[model samples]
Target: MSSKHKYLNDWAAYFDETGKVTRFAFRFFREAVKPPYEFRELLKQCYVIGYQSLFLVGLTGFIMGLVFDLQSRPTMIEFGAESFMPGMIGISIVREIGPVITALICAGKIGSSIGAELGSMKVTEQIDAMEVSGTNPFKYLVVTRIMAATLMLPILTIAADGIGLFGSYLIESYKGDVTFKLYINKVINILSFGDMVPSIIKTFFFGFAIGLIGCYKGYNSEKGTAGVGAAANVAVVIASLLVFVLDLIAVLISDIFYEL
Candidate 1:
């Protein structure tokens, strides 16, 4: 195939994969709402997906804040807006960067892990065996993962925002000679519900994308052990890319709403 043709083919394949994942996500939600809920499996997934990744998320959040503050200070100072640093940094972090970064980290950690785990189960015929024994593997496996991700991501984002703010405060104190109380007060004053809500809302979709794609890739895996690795790799890539796409949409929507 020509290079242009290969590019078009790749794009088409990408869209095809996206459509399949969306359909599977909708079906998973429909099945998940019915009876025979897998509460135990859901709890386990939450533990693995949420609590287990807290340390990594926290570390990243802290660094994100510190580096953002360090990087942004010179620009703000050059513009004679040094005093506005806290609010500007806070808005940038909470409004977009914080949630998106946290989601990407979760995608790398939880998405890949779920993919590998489910792919392994598929490879071992455990998923198939569950079906033969009259169990709904999709419900127990896919539903729980999607639900856990949908629920836990908002909580994780909240934690990340807080940690990021703290990181910013520390940097501001060290470099700009800003006091903690004043910095925090500026952050609070600048942060309306408009800044917080849209960012938090987008994370739910990010979580859903991560969980659904990861589970779908693993659940429908092929080629045995190699397929398991492939599923995990693909899950992280798709989930991370989707987080950025959704974040852009969320920003546009938030702007529309704010104007109204």
Candidate 2:
């Protein structure tokens, strides 16, 4: 194919995929509100996607805080601003890095897992079987997973932020002599409702995007077993991209709120 033709074709395919995902998302909304609520399934997903993933997210957050503080310490010391470390680190983590990093990790772990699981079911005809058996597979599978992710990610982010700040505190205590009480007080003074609420709120969107992309890719898998791997890979790539896009949009919206 010619370069121009190939570019046009790719653009068209992208739009087509976008339209399908949009419709899929709408269908999720429709199915979610009506029905025998899948509370048990949702709780199961929360345990699988949220609680199970906590150790990874918390470990990442701790390392992030430690490294971030270690890297920033020299600069702060040079300017005789070491006392500002806790507050600065807290704000940076809580307002931006914490949620984004946690989401990206979840995107890699949870997104790929969902995609692979559902893709395998698709390839094996289990989803079709469910449909034939009059089970609302979309509701039982997709909606519950999406809702669990959406609700659980903010909680994970909160946990990550706390752990990350504690990591920073450990570093601060080792480097200089700052008590936990003082460090926390400094962080509390610097952090405002504006910094936290928007950050936490945006995480729901991140989780939703991750879950939606995973479900969409898996639910539409083709080419048998090979398609399962492809679905997982594509779900991670797209979900990671969506996290950044959503974060940018969230920042813009938060800026507007901050201005007022």
- Error of model 1, residue 167, in angstroms: 0.8
What TM-score does structure 2 among the candidates reach? 0.99
> How high a TM-score does candidate 1 get?
0.94
Clashes of each: 0, 0
lDDT winner among the candidates?
2
Per-candidate local distance difference test: 0.92, 0.96
| Tens-digit per-residue lDDT, 1-260, candidate 1 | 99999999999998998798878978997998899999999999899888988889999999999999999999988999999999998899898888999999999998999999999999999999999999999999999999999999998998998999999999999988889999999999999998988888999999998998899999989899999999999999988988998888888898899899
Q: Please provide, for model 2 over 138-231, each residue's C-alpha lDDT reduced to its tens digit, 9 standing for 90 to 100.
A: 9999999999999999999999999999999999999888999999999999999999999999999999999999999999999999999999
Instruction: Give the poorly placed runs of model 1, Cα more than 4 Å off.
Output: 1-16
User: Which residue pairs show backbone clashes in model 2?
Assistant: none
